[model samples]
Target: MNKSTTIWGHLSAAPHRSLFLAGSFQALLTILWWSIELAGRAGLVAPPLLSGITPTWVHGFLMVYTFFPFFILGFLFTTFPNWMNGEKIRPNRYMAVCLLMVCGVILFYAGLFAGKLLISAGLLLMLTGWANAIAALFHVLLTAPAGDKRHAWVAGTAFVAGWLGLCAYALWVLTDNTDMLNFSRQAGIWFFMLPILLTVSHRMIPFFSSRVLENYVVIRPFGLLWLMVGCAVAHGILHLLDLQGYAWWADLLLAGCALYLSYVWQFFRSFHVRLLAVLHISFAWLGIAMLSFGLQGMLFWLNGGEHYWLGLAPLHMLVVGYFASMVLGMASRVTLGHGGFPLKLDHLTWLLFIAFQVVIVLRVIPDILPFAASMAPKFYLAAGGVWLSCFLLWVIKYAPIYWRARVDGKAG
Candidate 1:
């Protein structure tokens, strides 16, 4: 281990701590959003904090644009330096950009709640933040050195597209227009889900699994690029045509891909510990969510046999299971790496991982069972509580490391 004085000095100098603090603040916001929703359902509040906005839209926006971006920022900041051949990106500029983004999200949400001109102001802030982030990402791609720049390029492109789509979405929401909203949502989904997740899984999943099982072969799907492009086109067309039933087919294809990937993953490796296990577990949910979407589509084709709630199941699964799990896992990994700690996670970390999984079960499983809908709010509350607790645990366990910096004199 490095000397304590050296570590402390490095930690004080590093920007990783600042980024982590921003991320933690975003996590707290997420928990607060969920808690407020729960309170509304429980009749503790007269009017729901999120009354006017559609719950699906609200949740999607928060998960995709709000909470996820902070992690993305942290990841980019921490990883880009190494990718850039050990040159550190300017920290002060990055911090300023982050502050703008965080403040933008706050204003956007406040406007969403207030239903006033603040929405436009929030959108402006968001656009400014996005421009800064994109510029930073571009700088990394052009200047930073990486063995596999393809993944970074893909992620960057997707992020840009997602941000643009979000701008369109804001306009639509502000104007009470559905056409723009539909277009923006589809574009955003393609950018947020397809390229980003695909790149992430490609980069991390196989490597993570290989740690548990020796000599594991990661199977890459043939023509995956073509398939992804096709899906994006199909999704856009379906939205344009207002062909609701076609979503099932789209989902089915996606699910099939995920299932094939999962099989390949499992064949290659099995992890005994929660840290590694969580990655696979989260990917499993991605597959399951797709399957649920397909199932919902099939039921819709049966002519009014399916309940509206059927669709909500897959949405929740994607949001709570796949996205949340991945974020938590990535955040945990980053926290350890940036802090100059060993990669091995402790029991508390494992418990937190398990709690995240439990939140998925509690949130999604009940939607399928009608009788369970009555109990859904209770489960949601419980799950949200667990999620909040986990974040709190994260803050308690990791804050010092984030604040103090790496133990080694090396930069994150």
Candidate 2:
């Protein structure tokens, strides 16, 4: 092999130590949160630490900003080298940023549990960590030698913006500024949530679906999707400005987007793969989320309507159904493929996937039924149990693969 080929191979073959560390932290956090919830249910604490804004906010923020970013960095490190035709990009800075973020997460959570001084200190640390991570990512993106890699650039930028927004929001919360907090949340979602989801969904959905449907055609143009995103951002801004009277118009824009994305679905159905089917199914939830939010906005226009819990429904659906499902599916695929295992999933894996879907259903369906709110926590617990089990199974099944180099002596 030529030197270039050898370098590419080495870059690809490098151990994903960071990815594993981050994944482990994510899994541990998930398990810990659930355990706290379960304890609350058993009436152990006065009011469980898991019951309030601090826990929920910290959990959500860390999951998005802390846990997943590591995986993102690891993935980019592995894939970008190959994408750039074997150019090496050392990840020492990225790893350092990750470590800083982890420390920030711990400090932030501790402050929430402690009091105001801790909260202030934690926020400062978090901001510093996030800024470093974002800077490191930007440097990597600029130096990576890939031309017009729009998706990578978009995802990376969204992540940075999202974390920055989070930092601002944290400060607002510290100051007891409700308006700023609300605005920050809306800004953060647009800056972070939609972009990251679109980037990942676009890359993975078609690719994974194509695995089952040999003839699957993955559509590439996302101009229309970006337009929808613009509308969503506008809606967020209007709501923040208390001009939510115009929110209905924004919803109309999303409704139109739902229609367009539906066509994308029809195109996918033409290929017909079960693996692909799951992706389409998740996207369907996204479309449904858009429509639901639109409908809620319309209701608000019709009357002095309240912000319904139903909004949580679609958000959870996107997070758990679309984002989590995609992550689980891709991680499973990559772990198996890189481990020199067969592409085919075994019975256990299939069952785990099904269980994940069941969890989504249980978590989502209750929103349509208010009386069922009492039972929602139970379903969440059950879902959490199943999710934890799946991850454990994954660790058991793929630990060897992750630990040992590829059996074929080929680079990952």
Candidate 3:
């Protein structure tokens, strides 16, 4: 068997290739499915169909658990070894993870048509994949150097939390338990995705900026890090305990910290380079999202649950603005750097990234325009449509690099 030229060989050659490729496709597919469902529900198409789980729950599950993990795991697998001077993750280990997860997601889509049993089985498989990733990361943590393993430790714990959230989701699929569903959704956002993304941003964004922007001082304060983490976890715990109203303090503090870092990280200077600009722009949304969350919560509390302005606005901002934008920026950088291309984006991709900002606006418009209740679904369709299109184009631009050898003749 010629291992060098085979598709399998190329895919499994590096940890990021197959996983990132799969993630890009998953990102496209999930949104496409959502857009279809939205159109159908809005009566722009045929009647909508429901699988074993309700569409709302299904959307939450896929967005939180399925879509982002592939990219997250791919990035970590490539960086963890370097981060800790630990051993590179074995191809077999990450391969097992990728295969299991890809198959599990396919099964989930299929399960939508088949039955609840198939859906349950799919969830179990995904949980197993999550377990595999967690174990691999845990190994890195165990062997990492003693100096400042805090990011590693925090990111590792977030992965573990995500796995637990997947467990909760699996239980929800199996038993139709709302509590499990709620736990999975809330924990996936706060305990799982937030910590990891924040740590990566805190660790990398400044580092990335300093490398490109002259006179950029990289100030990574551990005190600020812990404070952000504290506020995030506190807010998460408060929401989980159904004391969401009291979370205003934590959310406001988080917003302030995020904005402070954005400024100190030289958000203004980033526009000098498109690649760095994208990362800065994405991080900018975190402050906006948190500010929205805190202000909305404060209003709700102050008005005695009577004035929740901008319902769902903050979440859409986080997911589309912060999460997806970072994914695009980070993944673009990874694909270019790892694939032996120049570290800059072209005009077309830059425009696509701008389009993503439009997507955030479209999504949040509906939330803020709750007065236009009749038009909300139309706005949902528009947001979903734009999101699907952007990712589709993005996948087209980047996915091929994963399967082909490096352009510069360097091995991955």
Candidate 4:
């Protein structure tokens, strides 16, 4: 019996399909909700404030927790088996994760209009789903036959850290402890998402580039990878300890390593293929973001820790510029390759990606230009609008492929 005939059947047909499909919907929903909130803040309209919750805290929580894990777990679930040549993850396993997470997100939205109790309850559900995801991936890691498990191990360890971070968030919701919330944000980004994203990019980018360009030398420095990961953790720890001014060396060193990789990757050489080009471009943002962080920290230190420069621009570059763009590019490449379509970035998708770059710029502008500080809310609203537009357009272009039968007559 072919399961591809029905919508539900097609969704569960593959690990990536169900997870990515749900993630795509989430990608739209999270940003749309945030954008509306931003509009209200900018005096565009009046939306009801969250109950017993600071909007910024909730915003950080939603972005950190509800959003990227869908794509991250989906990518890991789809790739882990092949990476280890191990047992395949069962449908029920991923479906359980998807259903729990989706329901949890819905409850979270309901909680926004309700109270802290609902919000805390919603996070508990999400935490459970997240734990299930980590366990499922760990099982794959643990059961794999004797082989190279560096990537799997690193990623799996990061998932555990992420799970703990989610727990912190839940605890924060319950106790109103800002320290827990802060730890959650730092752990979620630096310890968890950063490591996983870099690991994936490190593993995949050079391979993809090597295939397309003749005589391309793959330059993956594992030592550098370890160093960058260390610096990332150190930066987070410094912030946790309120020693941010001392993190200049780590941030700068990381910036150097990342920028060196970009130069070696040969950005201009891959533009002939838009798909490969996007990945390269996305990877380049890491260097740029870190450079911003390094310079900001350096400037802060030089001025006796008096004035902070660039404000949130560096962080935005990391979040949207590198993380979001990398997810978009990699997800698109995977979708096309797996769905039996030509592995090319079409003009519409390409334009949407370009527009996303504009979003990053808009987001960073208010922080950089001193005069624009007063208009930060308006700029943020515009940035949110552009960001939503990008995802909305791109999701519309690709979401159907998740559930549709592959056009190449291949099973998922």
Pick by lDDT: which candidate is best? Answer: 3
Candidate 1's TM-score reads 0.86
Please write out the lDDT profile of model 1 over residues 105-138, one tens digit for every residue.
Answer: 7776787678646766776777787778778777
lDDT of 3 by residue, 70-118 (tens): 9999999998888888878999999999989988999889888888777
What TM-score would every model get versus the actual structure?
A: 0.86, 0.80, 0.97, 0.97
Clashes per candidate (backbone, < 3 Å): 2, 0, 0, 0
- Model 2 clash pairs are none
Off by over 4 Å in 3: 1-5
* Count of backbone collisions in candidate 2: 0
Q: For residue 104, give model 4's deviation from the true position in Å.
A: 0.8
Report the backbone clash tally of model 3. Answer: 0
Query: Which is the winner by lDDT between candidate 1 and candidate 2?
Result: 1
Residue 87 shift from truth in candidate 4, angstroms: 1.3
Query: lDDT for each of the candidates?
Result: 0.71, 0.63, 0.88, 0.87
* Ranking of models by lDDT: 3, 4, 1, 2
Task: Extract clashing residue pairs from model 4.
Answer: none
